[model samples]
Target: MTTLITGATGKTGQRVAHRLQTLDHDVRGVTRHSTPRFDWHDRTTWAGAVDGCESAYLTFQPDLGLPGADEIIGAFAAQAVAAGCTRLVLLSGRGEDGAQRAEQAMTASGAEWTILRSAFFMQNFTEGAFADELAAGSLTMVEHTVAEPFVDADDIAEVAVATLLDKGYVGRVLELTGPQLLTFEEAARAVGGPGVAYLSMPTEDYITVLTEAGLPAADAAGLAYLFEEVLDGRNAYVTQDVETVLGRAARSIDGLAGGEQS
Candidate 1:
């Protein structure tokens, strides 16, 4: 049976697909551009993507915290199960209410599911939304004193691959985090050198900056919400789930910043 991967070209999705392939697992990575053309917004395209797949890795676009995400994810899970894809893995946020709702919906779908409730990704600095700003030598945000134990994307992908292939991890909700917590300013310095500047602005101003920088209005607003509401020190702690799942210590941001990870 095939394993389906949504968001196949995205950060974690790409990594998961590659790792599964390296392990010689049959992988069908689906995106809006794939041969099957799986689109999150277009329910018409879902059946073809889920057909003949025994398992799937789901990473919702925009985010799972958006309104109506629970409904959409629930529907997708039901479709996957009906199509005989019994194993489902979801990429979920750490401390978001909407994410929890989506999780519940997936669980209620009756598929064997594993939820990787992950911390802020370390790759946000190197390869994500903040990459351009960090590359420009300045990173700005709606600054708060809250620290986050940012998990490496590579670690998350490994865990996803493990859980998808191993039924022992079925029905588990693994909270994945790095070994240490770092505030935004500290993270900025770690990613760039000490000369790099970290700037804090009001939430609205930050949203304006992102929109002006060509980010969609909804995406900018979603990012602003995550920074202002979700980054309120609720997820400052680290977890051993990654170590437990992978049988190795989780990668630290320091290692990533030092070019230890390629």
Candidate 2:
């Protein structure tokens, strides 16, 4: 039996698949266009995606906040059950109501579940949303000027891999956060590169910038909602979950921003 990874194209999922493979586990990924196509928007793919799977790393793409995400998750949980998948490691976002809803659905699915609730990823700057802006010498976030302890994608992946491969994580909601919090400017400064400026702007202004950047309106809206509603000091506090799960302190942004001059 294989451990299926959803959203295999994403940063976290990519890391999870690699980690699982490194451990010599039978791992397979679900992608819309892959040999085993796993499109969450297409339920017909779920059965095939979960086929011959004893466990799964479930990461919803676009986001868990999308319309009907909860319903889709619940349905998928049922499919996992029918497919004989006993372990379901769900990737959930901290402070995200939609993720919480999806979590509840997974829990109620009757499978041994592990919810890896994670903080915002630091990869957003290098591999995700802020990558381009960072490259362009401008980075924008919802909060005008507050530090967020962005969790490393590797940390999230390691924790998820552990939960998926080990039984100790069953029924646990491991909330992994970075060791410290830093404002966007602090994070940029920590990048310690030639020069990275972090600016704080109003949520509306941030939304406008995102909209102007060619992101769909809905994505811009959700991002604005995340920044204004969720990231507004709610995630500034650092936690030891990373240390607890990985048996080591979380990696610092400075180390992660490798080769950048402060």
Candidate 3:
């Protein structure tokens, strides 16, 4: 059975594609600019990408919490089902209210659904915004010294591909997280080194740095909003979802960033 994966170039989606292809599955990588072109903003492109596929690994680009994501996800799910897609695995954010709305839309879109709810990814340090900060030897995060159990994209991908390729995982809400919890400073130190320090800057300072670095005003504002809104001491817990799914505990944040062992 062929499976189409949206956002196939992203941190988690790329791993999912690798896992699927390694197993020799007829994996289809869908993007906004593929030969058939599958832009999230265009409902017309999804039909071509999802055509004749029995399953789809749906991961919205930018983010599912972005404006009007629900409408777009709902429309795409409907089209996929109409085009004969049977199962859908939705990658959703953990504890974001908007994400729940989008997940419900997919659930009601006439396709069997499995939602993988995940907290902040550990890859943010090695591959994203935190990368520069780690390299700079300082990380000024707005989190209030709270612990967060970050999940690895590879682990999340393994579970997603398993659910997509192997059956019997329908209607499950797998909340993926790391095996241990680490505060923002601790998390930062793990990636960089003992020289790294986490500074709790004021919201205004945070906005200033983000803006000074040439980030758009809207994106800079959104970055502050994430630390202030979604990460207000609420995402500090460990879970066994990864172990349960992959038959082993999720990798730790420090281990992920640690240099190769001698």
Provide the overall lDDT of each model, using Cα atoms, as 2-decimal numbers. Answer: 0.92, 0.81, 0.82
**161 Cα displacement, candidate 2 (Å):** 1.3
lDDT, residue 125, model 1: 95
> Model 1 over residues 115-196: C-alpha lDDT tens digits?
9999989999999978988999989989688899999999999999999989999989999999999998888889987888
User: What is the lDDT, from 0 to 100, of the residue 251 in candidate 2?
Assistant: 81
Tell me which residue pairs clash in candidate 3: none
Clashing pairs in 1: none
- List candidate 3 stretches off by more than 4 Å: 211-215, 259-262
Taking all chains together, each candidate's TM-score versus the true structure is 0.97, 0.92, 0.91
TM-score head-to-head 2 vs 3, winner: 2
**lDDT tens digits, residues 1-262, model 2?**
5999988889898898998888888888878888778888898888888888999999887788655788999989988987799799998887788778989988889999999878778888788878877887866666644467778888898888777777988998888888888777777656536587666678788888888989888878776876676665666688898898778888877767884311
Task: Highest TM-score: give the candidate number.
Answer: 1
Count of backbone collisions in candidate 2: 9
RMSD of 2: 2.5
Sort all candidates by lDDT, best to worst. 1, 3, 2
Q: Give the Cα error of residue 86 in candidate 1, in Å.
A: 1.4
